[model samples]
Each structure stands twice: as structure tokens, then as C-alpha cells.
Target: MAEYAEITYTVEDRIATITLNRPQARNGYTVRMSDELADAFGRADSDEEVRVVVFTGAGDHFCVGADLSQGGFDFDGEPDGPWQEPAGRCAKRIFLMNKPVIAALRGAAVGAGITITLSADYRLAATDARFGFVFTRRGIFPEGASAWFLPRLVGMGTALDWMISGRLFGAEEARAAGLVQRVYEPDELLGKAYELAREIAASTAPVSVAVTRQLLYRMSGLDSPLPVHELDSKLIAGLPAHADSVEGVVSFFEKRPPKFTLEVGKALPAYLPWLDS
Candidate 1:
């Protein structure tokens, strides 16, 4: 329930929704908004009651890119020091979160707008949504670690084409390129996102979801299967003793939905993120 200047954070059922709130500005990205977003994600990660997160924007636009009202040199004003870029901070937080995140995208999502959602688990876009990589046209490169995430989400060829051209494209192209999972009518986007979120919250084990999210994202970068095999061995060997595993088995035999009690904040496995030998 923390207050934010450029965003709204609220929780209902087991889903935490983070809404970009500057409708007049077209939900433009700003340094303050990045910090607030990171904080909100941290809050959701630590709250045992929160099982999923939904991200969206207010008004007609998801985001139109950086707020340039401060002038053309706004980005250059960052104090000279080794520091994480504003957009990267928020994106990194989303990447590391234990809870699943779904983005309900509509209207325009350009530059930082689209890049920020690259780390989300799923993106449900409105059929009318427009997307642009726009950074090349602005005389800057992609930020928000899109250089790394974009290639992984969409193939390197598509990533390079979109980013190099920096042209606007429609949601259908986005879905074909694998940037979005599904497309819905403008008014139905959020409702569909929430419905998916509720299903995950109600049916999945929190600890298993947390571990699976990290495993998939983190392991995708590995060059060999040995690392994955090692991690899988450890997880399979240890998971049999967990309460969630017992309940899952019992429920399958009893033909009933499982009520998982293992909490992500308190019950996550200690050997997660598998260290190399």
C-alpha cells in the first residue's frame, strides 16, 4: 500500500498490480518512476500474500518513452559515476522477482516502455497496441538491458531488425515476433491479465513457481546442459521432502485441488540459483 508519485500499487486477492500513473504524460518513463517501480517489486517479492504481479498503464497509453520535458540533455544529466541506468534498475528488479509478472499492454509502448516489459513472464497486449524500439531514431541505443533481454525474448534477427530500424509496429507483428503471448480487445486486456493471474495464484505452489521462474530465465543463458542437470538433480532429490510435494501427490490421487502452504518468502530452497563448482 505504499504511495508513489508516478505509479499506483495495489493488491487484490493474491495479485499485485503496478500501474504507471502519469496519464497526462502518456505514462512517460522517468528516474523517479524507475525507483518507485523497483521498490514496488521488492515489496511484492517480500509479501507472502502476493503470488503474482500485473503491470499496466493508465489512460490510453502504456508508455511513450522517456519524459523529455526536462530538455534534450535529460539523460546526460545523470551524475558521472558508475551507476545502473534508470530503466535497467526497474527491469533488473522485474527479472529477479520471485512472483510471476504479467504485463497488460495497450495503446503505445515505445522505447523504455516496451523494453521494460521484456523481462516480464508474459505480455498480454491489446489488438490496437502500437510498439516502437525508437531508441535508434532518438540517437541513443536501447536501454533497460534490452540488448540482452530482447534477443532472448525474440530471436536475435528480429531484435536487431526492430531496434535497428526503430520503426513503429502493431500488436500483430509483435505477437508474430514472440514479443507478446496473446492479444485481446482494448477493454478486455486487464481483465484477461487478472484472470490469468488469479489462476496462477490459486493453482500453483509459490515456492515451485519461484524456483521455476529463476531456473528458466537463469539457465537459458548457460552454454551447456551440465549446469542444468546438476541443478535439476539437487532440486529433484530435495523436493520430495517438502510439504508442497506431498500435498501435490495426495491431491492428485484424491482428485482434489491442492492447497499449498509453502510460502516463497519463508520456504524457498536454500540451494537455489545453483552455484558452479
Candidate 2:
């Protein structure tokens, strides 16, 4: 029931679509848009009927980065203020969501635009999509925790190269460097994203996907597999009693689609340490 002025949020067929609405401005990034995006992400994450989130823009462009209409940034906030950088809030919200997020990008996805989508589970871009870590060029630091997420996705060397150079790259380069998972024509981009989202919604157990996502992001960078092994043991031990486990097994044996009834908000195991954090 939330109302958004800078973005449109709608849920249908288990997918929540969040579109940046400032098309005339080429979906320019703004503080209002950032907060609205965070709110929409939280709403979809909490909605049991929304198993996936599609992040996209309404017009030809996804986002052309900050609205620079006022000439430049105004940095007059009190040092002791509780204010958070708006873009970081959006990134953090998306990072913590239990439901999967797929960002569909076309045209210009530069500066904050590109950085924000780096946290999504999947980035599907149109062939015309152009991306840049343009903060250095703009005389500002990168937002959306790009330093951390970029290196993990594209490697430290490529991250350093693109970030330091502040150069724009096309979708093919983005895919080759691992920044995006797929590329398609602009017209076909959203269709493919929805197709992949549908596949996930139909085949995967919601609670299981949530746990596995957290495990991969939270545990994969460890120096050794010992901790992961221990956590995996704990997770595997409880699977027999899990409702989704039963449904998955029965559906597989019967050669039918799984009717996994476990809701992500409720069915995540209590032993997950990060849930409390």
C-alpha cells in the first residue's frame, strides 16, 4: 500500500517490479528515489506473495546517475547527524533481502546507477547498456559499497581499472568481466529477466533459496571451507524436518512441479546467526 512518487512498485505472478519513474530526467538519481527504492525493496522482501524482485527503469535509460541539475552536490550536513548516504541505504536493503533481486539495465547505467545494481543477484543488461564507475571522474567517491562488491564480482584488477579510470564500458565488456550475467536487445531485456525470474519462482523453494543466498554471500569468502562445512552440516541435519524438504522430495518423485509452501519471512532456520545480526 506504500505510495511512491519517484518509482512505481507492483506485484504480479509472484514478482515485484520496481521501476525508476523519472524517465524525463533519464531516471536521474536523487535522494528521494534512493529512499523510495529502499522502501520498495523492503516491501517486496516482506511480501510472501513476492518471491522475486525485478529492478528496472521505465524509459530507454535505467539511470543516468545523479541529477546534476543544481550544478553539483551540496555537502552541508552536520557531521554528528544521523543521516545515511541515500544510495548506500538502497544497496544495503537490497543486499539483506531474502527474495532474489534481478536488475534489468539499458541505456546509461553510470556512476551511482551502476554501483547500486552491483548488489543484485542477477544483472541482465541490454546490448546498448553503458556502465561506468564514474565517481572519480565526478570528483566524488563511489557509493553503494562498490569497492567491496565490485572486486568480488569482477576481480580487483578490473575493479581498480574501471573505478580509477572512470571509463564507460558496453554490455559485452560488462558480461565478459562478470559485472553482468546476460545481455540482450533492449526490447527483449525485461522479457528475459522475467523469464529467468519465473524459472526461479517455479523451481526453487523460497526458504531454501534465502538460506543459500545468505550462505554464499556470507560464507564464500572465507579462507577455509571448515566453517562452511560446519554450517552446512547444521543446515543439512535439519532438512529432514523442513517442510520444503518434504515437498521437494515428493514433487521430484512424482515428476511434478514443487509446491513449496514455506514463506521466507517465517521459515528461515532459527540457527542462522546472521538473521539475528
Task: Indicate the residue-level lDDT of 114 in model 1.
Answer: 90
lDDT of 1 at 120: 96
On TM-score, the candidate that comes out on top is 2
Q: RMSD for all candidates, in order, please.
A: 2.0, 1.5
Minimal lDDT window, size 10, model 2 = 73-82
Worst 10 residues of 1 by lDDT: 71-80
Q: Write the residue-wise lDDT of candidate 2 on 1-277 in tens digits.
A: 3589999999899999999999999999888898899989999998899999999999999999888888876343564767777678788898898999999999999988888888899999999999999988878898888898999999999999999999999999999999999999999999999999999999999999999888988998999999999989999999889999999999999999999998887888888879877
Which segments of model 2 are wrong by more than 4 Å?
74-81
Using Cα atoms with residue i matched to residue i, what is each candidate's TM-score against the true structure?
Answer: 0.95, 0.96
For candidate 2, report its TM-score: 0.96
Off-target runs (Cα >4 Å) in candidate 1 are 73-81, 274-277
Q: Whole-model lDDT, candidate 1?
A: 0.91
lDDT of 1 by residue, 43-116 (tens): 99989999999999999999998888878524435567876777888899999888999999999999989988
Error of 2 at 161 (Å): 0.6
